[model samples]
Target: MHDSHNSTAARLFETEGTGNPLDVLKRVYGYSAFRGKQQDVVEHVVAGGDAVVLFPTGAGKSLCFQVPALCRNGVGIVVSPLIALMRDQVEALKQLGVRAAALNSSLTRDEAIAVRHSLAAGALDLLYVTPERAVTDAFADMVADTDIALFAIDEAHCVSQWGHDFRPEYRGLGCLASRFPGVPRIALTATADPHTRDDIIKRLGLDRARVFTTSFDRPNIAYEIVERDQPRQQLLRFLSRFKDASGIVYCLSRAKVDDTAEWLNTQGIRALPYHAGMDRALRDAHQDAFLKEERLCLVATVAFGMGIDKPDVRYVAHLDLPGSVEAYYQETGRAGRDGLPSEVWMAYGMADVIQRRRMIDEGGSPEEIKRIERGKLNTLLAICETAGCRRQAILAHFGEAHPGRCGHCDTCLKPVETWDGTEAAIKALAAVYRTGERFGAGHVIDVLMGTINEKTERFGHVDMPVFGAGKDLPPRTWQSVFRQLLAAGLIKVDHSAFGALQLEPEARSVFRRERQVLFRKDRPSSGKAARGTKSATARERSDLAGSDLELFEKLRSQRLAIARDMDVPPYVVFPDTTLIALAKQRPRGFEDLLDVPGIGESKREKYGEAFLAVIDAFEEGGG
Candidate 1:
C-alpha cells in the first residue's frame, strides 16, 4: 500500500489498504466511490506520505483526510482554523462511530483534561485542534511520544501572508514536522492562487510534498456580476429567487451589514447581521441561529463566514467587490457544499472599486497600496467583464487553464456579444477631461446623456463637444466600457487632482489611434437565459407538473425507508446526484446500476440485490 518514489504514489494506497477501503466507503460514508481524488489522496496519507491538496468547495475535500484518519494506524492530528469547524467535524465523525475529539479554548478545564486523557489512552482515532492549541508544549510532547500516523493541516492557505485570510500563527506549524519527523503531513486548502500556493508551501516547509489539485471549478454555481446601481433592489430580486432558502449576503462595512439585514427583515426574509462591531453575544447567537435553523440567511461583512460547514447554503451574494480573487473564491465557494445547485451573484461598480483602493491606500505604503489596488481592481474587473466562462476565469486567475466554457456559468448559458467601443471610450474619456475631471461617474454620466437636470446645467456641462456623443449607446454600456478601461489601465483616477481623470501610459495608444476598445452588450432575456442565470434545478423542482413530481416523491419515500433500515442518511444512501443520475439513466439491472456514479463494488454487493430488484419491479410495472 506504500510507495515512496513514484509520483503516482497516491494511487497505490487506494488498491492496498487494510482491506478494500471501498467496502468501508459504501457502508460507512454511504457512497459508492470517493469524489475526485479523495480515494487516492486518502491512500497517500494512510501510506505515510506528505501531500498538499487543493479541492474546490463541495468537492468532498474533508473525506480525503477523514477516511484515511480512520484507516491509518495510531491517531491522526488535524490542525484546523475555527472552533466551529473543529466542533462540527468531531460531531460528524462521532455520529459515524469514529473516535474523534476536539481540543480548543472553547472547552472547560476538565473537558480539556478528559480529551488529553483520551488521547493518552489511545481512545481516539482523530484529534482536532486549532493551530494555536497545537503549538503548545504539551501537544508537542504528546506528538513526540505518540506514534501519530498523520498530521493534517486544514485550511492551510492561512499559512500564507499572501492569502486572503492570513494568520501569523499558521506560519509556526512547520514545527510539527520538526517535533515528529516520521509522521506524514497533508495540507489542504480550498482556495489559493499560484503566489499564495507557493507561499503556503514555503511557510509550511512542505517542499518535498506531492501536490494533488482537483480542479478548482464549481460547475454547479451560476456566477453573475452586475453593476451596483440600486444594489438594495438588486439584492431583493436575488433573495426573491431563494424565497426562504439558506444563503449569505456579504457586505464590506458593519453598518452596511446591519442596514442590509434590517432591510431584508422588512422584506420578510428571516435574516441576521454579523460583524466584528456587534456585541459578542449577539454575534455568537446570530451565528448559532443561522447554523441550527433552516432557511435563515445571514448578511455579514468580510469578518464572517470562514470555516462554515453548512452543506446546503443555496446561494452567496456579495454586495461589493472582494479585495482579491482568492477572497472572492473562498467567500463564494461557501455555497453549494453539498454539490447541489447554487448561486454566486455579485454587484460591483466604480464606487466599489474606488472604495477598496482607497482603503488599501490608507493602510499601506504608496507602493504597497498600488500593488494591492492593481490586484484588486484586476480581480473586480475580471468578475465584471470576463467574456469567457466565469469558472474558467476564476481558475485561470489561480494559474490553472480551463479547457473551455464550464457549461454552467451565465456567460456559457447566454453568451455576451461584444462590440467595438473605441469611439464611445474616446468620447467618455473626452467628456471626463472636458468637464475638468472634477466629478464622479454620476455627474459625468449626466453630461454624456445631455441630461437637462440642475446638476448638469449647474456646471454648464451639457454644452461640451463630448456631451451627448455617447448617447448612441446606453449609459449602462458606457459604464461597463469605462470600468473595463480603468481596469485595463487606459485611464487612471487622480484623487490628488480633485478626483480628476488622467490618461494612463496605455491611454496613449488610444490617443495615438494604436489601440481599439471593445465592450459587451446586454443580451435579450429568454427562458433558457433566465433559467440558466440562477438555480434552474431548484426552479425545475418547483415548476414540475403534478404527476411527474408526485412519482418522484413516491420513489424518494421508498428510498428513505430503505436508507433508514440500513441506518444512514437518505442522501447518503442515494445522493441527489445519484438519484438524478438514475432518473436520467433509468438503470434496469445491476450492469446499468454499476455504470452510475457513486456506485462501486461494495454498494453492488450489499444493497445492490435489493435496489436492482426494485428497479426491475419498476421497469416491469412500466415505471
Candidate 2:
C-alpha cells in the first residue's frame, strides 16, 4: 500500500511524525499556508488514516484531500454528488498542473471510456465519480483492482436519512470500506449538525475515523432577513449593489424560478432559470453559463447549488424560507469563497411560514421524523423573528457559541424593538378553538379583526366572542401573532384539516396567562425598506474604482472572447478571482502575472501572454 501510494516523491508524507505536504500545497494549489486544521488533515490522510472533516465553507477542505492525493502516486477516487462540482474542481486542478478527470453522466460515452482507460493504465492523480457509479459492479471491480490512494466522500451528510439532501445512492458508499479494507476513507461535509454527523459516521462505516471540526462562523457573509413586502421590488433593490456580479436567487418552486428569471431579465439583469424539471441538457447549459459568464444570475430551485464551486458568487437571495438552518447555511455558504464580502438575503412572508409548516406535516416521514423536522423549522423561524443577532442565533443552532453580537447581520446593525404579545396570543388561540379549529391562520386573524367576509359569515365565525375583541391591531400585527404562535408550538398546523390551525394541548398554560409571549416589534412596514448592500470589502475585479474598474471590464470582455473561442466556460479559462487580481495589480509581464494569486505555472504557460497583453495595452494607452 505504501509503495503504491507515494507520489513519485522518494518519501511518503506522514500523518504522525513529519512530511512536506505544505510544499505540495504551495507548488500546486498556490496556497502558502494551511488554514485551521487543513495541515493536520493532510498529514493524517497522506499518512494513511481515515478522517471525518467538518470544516466550514471557504475553510480550504479541498486541500485536505487534494494535497494527499497529489502526494500519493495512485489516483484518489473521489465520490462527489454533482457533475458541475466535479467539473469545476477538475478545471481548477488542471490549472494547477494536476492530472484530474471526471466520469459522470454528462460525459460522452467516448469521454467516459477514455477516463476508464486512463484509470486502468494508472495515468491520473484524481478520478471523480458519483456514488451511483461507484456502486456499479463493473466499476466496483475496477476500483477493487486499482492501486487506490484512498477514497473521499464529499457532501457526506447526504448519507443521513434525516438530512435535506439525502440521496439513496449514497447509502451504498459504506461498501467501499468493506471492499477495500486497507484503503483509507475520508467523509467531508460543510453542513452537518451533531445528529447528521453521527449518521454520517454510522452510514459510511467510519467508526474509527478521526473527526476534525473547524469553526462554523463565516464572517465574510453579511446576513439579512426581510419581511416579504412587494417581494420582486425588494429583491431588485437588494440586488442593485450587486449589479454586474454573479449570484443565485433561489425560489421554492420550479415555475417560480422560471417566472423570476424572466422577470429579472426584463429588469436588465442577466438571469437564467434552472430546476430539475428542465431538460438535463438545458439545466446543464444554464448552470455552465452561470459559472462561465460574468454578471449572470441563476434563478433556480433547491435543485441547484450544493455542488457549485464558484468562488466569486457575491450574493444568495432566498425568495422563500428554507425548511432548516442547515439547508440555508449550506446554500448560502456558496458565496465569497475567495474571502471577499458577500451577502445572504432572504425575503419571507406569512405564506412562506405556513407553507413550510404544512409541508412538514404532509411529508411521508414517520411521526418522529416529522417532529424533528418541525423543530428545525421552528428554530429557523426563531432566527427570523428574534430581536437578537441573526448570525449568533445561526451559529448557536450548530452547537457553537458566539458571546457578543456579530455586527454583520441585519438585527445587529439595526436593533429590533420588542413588545409583549401575550394578550394577543391568547386571543389568537381562542379564535382558533372557538372556530372549531377548522380554519388557517389567515381566516383566524380575519375573524379576530371583525372582518365580515363571506367565509366568516358562512362559517358563523362572526358571532364568536373573540370577533372584534382584537380589532385594535392591524392585519400585519395579527399575522405576526399567528406566526409567533406557530413558531412557539402553541398552535399546530393540521395538514389534513385543509391547513387549519389547532391549539396545542400544552398551550393551556399560555392561554391562562401563565406564559408571557414577547414579540420583536417589527420594523415599520412603510415606503421603501433599506437593504444592507456591502459596497466595500474585498473588491471583486469589477468593483474597482476609476481606471481599474474600466480595465476590469475590458479584461472580462477579453476573457469571454477567449472562452467563446475555446468553447469553454470563462471560469474554465480563469475564474473571477483571478481576473480581479489581474485588474487590481495590472501584471506587466509573465513574472508579474505568475505573481498574481491564481496563476499557477501551468496556467501561466498556457494563457498568461494574452492576459499580460491586455494589461500592457492599457498601460501604453494611458501614456
Candidate 3:
C-alpha cells in the first residue's frame, strides 16, 4: 500500500504543471480549491516569501505550508514542539503519499540514522524536528550541507512569553533567520492574542513576513457554560448525548482527572486519565489510546491537547474555569476540527473563581505579568457571565468583531434572564466589609443570612449592622451575585488572606448608589437542558437518512479496520467528512471516487477499491 501510494505521488509530480499549487491541491490532496487565505499564503511561500498564518484549528493551516513545500524546491524543514504532534502529522502526510519524516527523541538510533540518510539523499519532502534538536550545532551543520527549502514553524505562539503555552526552547529558534537568511519561513498557530502575536513576530524574527489573520470564530462549535451544581452529574448529562463519540473532559487537577475517569468508567463510559504528573509511559499509552479509540473520553489537564491532530473530537467539556480567554479558546477549539458541528461545555462556580484567582496570586510570576493575567482572567469571567452571545464575547476578546447573536451558542439558543442586581451587589459588598474583609464568600454569606455558624460567632457576636442584611434572598441567588461581582471587578479575592472577599475600588460607586448593576438570573439545573436539544449526529449527517446513515457506519467500520491493519489512526485513512460524502454519493468506481472531497490520487489508487466494495455490498443487500 505504501509503495502504491508513493508511486501515485511520483506520477502526480511527473505530470504537466507539477509545481502548480492548484494542480497539487486537486491531484495530491484531492481538494478542488483553497479556502480563505490559503491560496495567497501558498503562493507567497511558493514564490520564496516569508509569512505568518493565524488560521483557526480546522482552517487548513497545514496545507498553507504543505502545498507550498510540495511546490518549491528541496525539503521543507518543520519545527514542531511535541513528539506526538510530529508523529501524527508525519503519518498523515505519508498517507497522502508525501515523503515525510520526523527527528525526535522517540526514534530509535537506526531509525534516526535512516531519517538523516533520507534527508542527505533529498528523498524526503518534509522533515519535522523539535526546537531543542533544530537549534543544536550538529543539526544546523547537517542542514547547512543539504539543499534546503523554507522553514515552517508550527505552534509559533510558543515563542512568545505572553502565549499561554510558551516554551523556552522556542527562544533559540530566533537564530533561524540569521542562519538561513534567504529561506522563506512561515509561522502558524490557531490561538494568539494581540500581545502574543506581536511577541511571536518579534521573537521569531518574522518582522517582514506577511501576517494573515483569519477570523477566530468557530461557528461549528456550540459554546455552553453552566453554573457548577453537581458538576459530575452535569458532565454526565452532557456526555449522555455523545455516548458513542470521542471527546475530552478537562479538569484543573490531577486528582480530579483520575477520579473523573474512574467514575466515568463505573458509569459505563470508556475514559482514561492524563496529566503531567502521570508516569510518562502511562501518559503516552493513554494518549495513544485516545487517538485510536472511537468511543472514549480522556479526562485530562491542559497538558493533553497542545497539538492534537485528531479531527473527529465531538466535544470538549471543562469541569473548572480556565485561566484566561486565550486558554479557553485554544482548549475548546480542539473539538470538531473537521468543520462539522460540535459542542464545548463548561461548568464553573464561585469556588472555581476563588481557586483560579488564588493560583494566579500565589504564583511566582512578576507583578506585571500577574496583573495582565488577572486582567485576562477577568475578561473570561465576563464572557461566562454575559447574557448576550457567547460567541460574540469570545471573538471580541481576540479583537475579531462578530455580529451579535451567532444563533449557535447557549445564549442565542435560550436567552438568559437578567435582574436589577444593584441592591444585591451593595449588600454583598457590605457583608464582606462588615466581616473585616478577611472571610471568604461562605463566611460572608453566613453573616449576611444570619446563620449563627461557629466561625461567624467566633469572628463576631453576630450582632454587626450588616448581619441578616441579605436574609430575603436564597443562598444560591447570593452566590450568583458574588460570582458576578468578582467577574465584574467590583470585588476581588485576597489570596494572601486565604481566599477572602474584598471590595475593589469600583465597588465604591455601587455602594454610593451611583452605579447600577445587572446580573443574569441563575437558571435551575435541568438535565434535559444540559443534554442539548439537537441530535448529536444531526449536524454531521443532517442530509443522510435511512440507508445512507447505515452506509456511513459501514464505511467508518471499513476505515477503522484498514487503519488498525496499518497501525494508524482511523482519520488517517479518511476523515468522517469524506466518509459522509462517500455514503451520500455512493460513488461506483475510481473515477467517481476521485470526485469525493478527500480522495487524492494516492488514496484513490490505494483504498478506492475497498470503499467501492463496501458501497457495492450495500447496494447488493450484503451491508
- The collision pairs in model 2 are none
Q: Give me the candidate number with maximum TM-score.
A: 3
Give the deviation of candidate 3 from the true structure as CA RMSD.
Answer: 2.4
- Per-residue lDDT of model 1, residues 1-623, tens digit only: 11112222122224322635566576445577776788888788777789999988788878777777667777889999988778767765654446789999999999999998888877777899989878789778765656576889999999976777789889889887787887889999999888888988888889999899978888768787766667788787777778646899999999999999999898899899999999989998888777655568899998887888776688899998898888899999998877777888887887777677666655554575367556755775766776767787788887888886767777876677888877877777777778886876667877888778888888887777777777777777766777787777777676655455566677667766788877777543221223423443455355444444544555566666776675444544554555555555556665555677766444544455556555556656776
Please, what is the whole-model Cα lDDT of each candidate in the order they appear?
0.74, 0.83, 0.89
**Residue-by-residue lDDT tens digits, candidate 3, 137-197:** 8998988877677899999989987877879999999999898889899999998999899
Q: Each candidate's root-mean-square deviation in Å?
A: 7.3, 5.0, 2.4
TM value for model 2: 0.92
**Could you arrange the candidates by lDDT from highest to lowest?**
3, 2, 1
Q: Of the candidates shown, which would achieve the greatest lDDT relative to the real structure? A: 3
Which consecutive 10 residues in model 3 have the weakest lDDT in total? 1-10
Q: How does model 3 fare in lDDT?
A: 0.89
**After superposition, candidate 1 runs with Cα above 4 Å error:** 1-20, 365-373, 431-439, 442-477, 494-500, 522-529, 532-623
Clashes of each: 0, 0, 0
TM-score, per-candidate, Cα-based: 0.81, 0.92, 0.96
